[model samples]
Target: MNRLYHESEDWVAQGSCRQYDPELFFPVSTTGPGLHDAELAKAICRGCAVRRECLQWALRAGEPHGVWGGTTPEDRRYMRRDLPLPAAS
Candidate 1:
């Protein structure tokens, strides 16, 4: 885990989707209502104060699932490629 994550646990409590089902953010499919659910998850993230930090954590952690910082996994993958992170300490 990174220092930011260790220091940012409180931010997760402030996330808009905290009360929603975790599965909603991690849909099993990308088709049909699943896509809509992802958008809904993003909507919640947009309202979160720690959206940027959440995204950074997800990218650095190489999260393979779920929505974070209003972005999908595919979004993070592209980001990781375009904005390579430094090796973990």
Candidate 2:
């Protein structure tokens, strides 16, 4: 799939989550205790310099799970509703 940003931009390398456990961004559930993990992930994202790039990438890729760009899968679903469809290659 095409990326929303150039590879050389390397935004992923700058995410605040880089210093945390990868599992923290992939909560088992969005409810109950899993919600706590999600919140923690969001806290990290809040301070990330590449947050907008990460979120736009996730939305363009139709990411279906995990916390991305400080947003849950459900959150992206709602956000995707108003996005323009990507052009066919």
Candidate 3:
């Protein structure tokens, strides 16, 4: 069964995640201002209602790539360093 936090029947109302696609959201590293797309993804979490749940899902799923809760790989690494890591079993 799907684990972590799956969208409830009503979560689509937030209208944020609909634009998020793991493959497409990879961190575009360039010499620019602000967080990379990777970081911007994580930064968005600041105001996100499901930030905690999103972080949990990313850590538990062992998602090696993509952004979650507006956080990128490095951001997630720092945040989840002490969390129970779920192997990508």
Candidate 4:
């Protein structure tokens, strides 16, 4: 994938991302299914607080799995290519 997975020390929870949910057992639901799950992931992301931060981290670091904040790896790919990426926090 186009994601760059790396850790960020400045990850502020602009909102809740399932990425860090200890209660989460399985990967975000998009791994197996097609973009259907990606759409679902986006819906779940609707209320996320740190969605931007998570997206930036993913784009800058090329995160590859699960949902970051709210957006998926594919979403990050589009955003990174389309929008101006934020600096690492």
Candidate 5:
């Protein structure tokens, strides 16, 4: 997998959630608490300029946790199922 960190356009470094608790994005709550936390994290993503790239990075890395790119782990799983498989080398 390629790393976007070294690129000049990487916006994740400037994410607003950077100052918040990491656990906020990895909420263990499956009820109202979790939902609320997820929303908070997503609120940050909604205004992020690098939201798409952050999401793609998480998907490619098979990130198993967190509300990355404004999506929950389950959301990313659904997305993964819809992605086209890479061609064999």
Candidate 6:
């Protein structure tokens, strides 16, 4: 198995986005035409089998840009606000 797969990121290989351009998930903006791009990405994510895993990963990693798991950066930021901060080490 690939190192990435061994690390448990294998679900990425099953994502519907694989059939499309990666740029579709990294729109330049979040308004106007970018909104359309985001919607397109979300459409792809909606049918993905690993969407929940993708979203969880993005949230945990504090991903700062692009679309993930059918959600835009702004969407994730809002969602993060509702989550408790990590405990101190």
TM-score of each: 0.75, 0.80, 0.52, 0.50, 0.73, 0.81
Error of 3 at 66 (Å): 1.4
Per-residue lDDT tens digits for candidate 6, residues 1-89, read: 11142246867777788788878888998787787888888888999898898889889988887788888888888788886433322
Which one is best on TM-score?
Answer: 6
- Candidate 5 — which pairs collide? none
- For 1-89, candidate 2 gives per-residue lDDT tens digits of 11224345568667777678878888998778798888888788888898899898888989887888888887888787876533322
Candidate 2 residue pairs that clash: none
Query: For candidate 1, what is the lDDT?
Result: 0.73
lDDT of 4 by residue, 22-76 (tens): 3231244545544455555555566666566666665677876666656666556
TM-score of 6: 0.81
Candidate 3 residue lDDT tens string, 1-89: 11224455343345355555543355554125423554555555566776666667677767766666555665567666766433321
User: Could you tell me the TM-score of candidate 4?
Assistant: 0.50
Stretches off by above 4 angstroms in model 4 are 1-15, 18-37, 83-89
> Which whole-number lDDT from 0 to 100 does residue 71 have in model 4?
64
For candidate 4, which ten residues in a row score worst on lDDT? 1-10
Query: Can you give the lDDT of residue 59 in candidate 4?
Result: 69
> Would you give me the overall lDDT of model 4?
0.53
TM-score of 3: 0.52
Q: Tell me the lDDT of model 6 at 87.
A: 30
